[model samples]
Target: MMDSPDSLVYLDGVSKLYATPQGLLPAVRQVTLDVRAGEFYSLLGSSGSGKTTTLRLIGGFEIPDSGRVMLGGEDVTQLPPHRRNLHTVFQNYALFPHLNVAQNIAYPLKIAQLPSAEIKLRVEAALEMFRITGLGERRPAQLSGGQQQRVALARALIGRPKVLLLDEPLSALDAKIREEVRQELRELQRQTNLTFIYVTHDQEEALALSDRVAVMQQGRVEQVGSPREIYDCPASLFVAQFIGKANFLTGRVLQTDPLTVMVQNLPIRASAMGYQPQLDETVTLMIRPEQLQIAESQPDAAPTAVQAATQAAAQLSVNQLSGRVIGDTYVGQLLQVQIETALGRLTATVLGKASLSSEVNLTWLVSACTVIPPALATMPSP
Candidate 1:
């Protein structure tokens, strides 16, 4: 396949395996990716999902068993790390404890055998750019985690590499500090306009920091898209469940036109944007917790009236389900409520709290639900 002209890094059918005692273990399987220049692209997955291995392959730390790695449209599969125009900021920060901040930032320039005056000038600029000008003499052990992170970033960027690779760089900081550093990292990327390939297992971190995210599972890439696209229109059930909290309903297809499914004898309208379910085919519907709206049920309303209202709403491509609130939990700004219906226990997130054992009505738009055909329920390993 031809690499995109804008792609700074391209992986063509890359695969890697490790020789384990159990036998050969596949770490990455025929993964093809195109990372455009000057974009924050993330490799997101849980542990053992090949995200780190893929990063290493691109960084020349690990060579693929098959396929090629392209950097700036040049094949660099067998090149060493220093030969490539890229820098990696690891999880541990990997700062030289013996050296101070300025010395650490100037190490790369010194290695290139640049003039001493130029090295000092660049080191000063890096310290000022990372807001650590006053801490130039502070060692890594004396600095806070966030400060050390910034120093490492300053060092990596001081070399002016074409791309920067980050491996869970904020995993060591506290929640508040991590959030602060994450924003700084994103802003830094934008200011420098350098391409970034970040690897992280945190879903929220990946979503908040990346321009595009590649969701990986069991050594393969399942889906790749913008944060909103990955969340709203997942390619597989794994992607949906991994990205955020999802409520699922199993039902059989009742109609193809505008796609309607029957759950517990109630017609539920769902979006068939990426899936096509045949007549009477068993399928699963996925709706995000935030997409569902809950309201108190009228005490004077009859069961027949509720049923009639549901049917009427279905005709307009809306889904209405009535149930008793079985669980309610206060989660800061949002209240999570679980409803026990005939179909199953469905969870929803609302702004206000609902009392347990109270009857309620749940409604969601047809576009809010994604239909997952059985074939896509579990993606097979490649």
Candidate 2:
């Protein structure tokens, strides 16, 4: 959260567990992460996935079972929430009931015992930062949800907290306002140089806002990578299924190479890996919904990329089933189509409705698929 270029916040082997009736329920199991200074990082997961717990741990509202929480490389695991110099903005914008916007923004400065003139200056500046200058006199009960969120943000920012903890602060607003505020938050983070630890279950929000994301599940990080890395090449089965629409075809490795793998007779392009597969190993082939395209039926021709794909053992092993469109849904700028092929039902996203007819032939380009070692499905999370 420090503005210094060399500073970072780290959670080394940080674990948070609860005493449940059955056993010690781990909410966050030995998470080790580094949030570089000035990065807009997100902790993305559903409820109980330990994202909020991570935020609370860094903010000092919750303690980890074991490990270190360091700020600017200084150990601060035992520090109280108030001593962490981080501010948290909740979904409901927990503003003081009796305080008006001006007082709410000024509250932190006042609590720090700054002079009245300085408090006024800070409050005005905070309001300006959020473009809510005229609403400073309005109490929380009198403002719209979006305005209330701004006030809460202003209150948190007035103290100039090193890190900003946003717990789905925009979730309560309408779609339009949510997008507006989302842009506002990102711009503010850019201008302020404050490290942000954002929590969210929404995939698009995470993809759009984060410099990097730590995708969580059942209290542990499954994959931590850039939006593109996580989406294009997921580390585990959980991550592939969690982040977006993915088609997985279970198969065994037929051949291996550093850049690609032949699985279940399908020539599957593998992710950028330091390790290659061994032949005959079990593996999962993953293709994103958008990655695949409906290839035009072709007569005999020389080997193209698709032809090379058609020749892969994986393609031969799996039954060839071109499908007809059973149904389709138009989602802004894209078409979500359901295809009933001989293999099974598969989903795809195309640019737009090519034809409204229920009969649409389907084939996928091999260039769009990749292989994930089947061992990952059962592998223990770190």
Report the error of model 1 at residue 43, Å.
0.5
**Model 1: per-residue lDDT, tens digit, 1-382?**
9888999999998999999999999999989999999999999999999999999999999999998999999999999999999999989999998999999999999989999999999998888888898999999999998899999999899999999999999999989889888899999999999999999999999999999999999889989999998998888888989999999888899999979999878889999986888999988899999998899999796669888887786758778888999998889999999999878898999997799999998989899999864544454344
lDDT of 2 by residue, 64-156 (tens): 988889888788999998888888998788999898989988988988999999888878888887778998878889998988998998888
What lDDT does the true structure give each of the candidates? 0.92, 0.78
lDDT of 1 at 145: 89
TM-score of each: 0.94, 0.86
Those runs of model 2 whose alpha carbons end farther than 4 Å from true positions after fitting are: 1-7, 258-275, 296-321, 354-367, 373-382
Among the numbered candidates, top lDDT falls to: 1
Model 1 vs. true fold: TM: 0.94
Looking at model 2, report the run of 10 residues with the lowest lDDT sum: 266-275
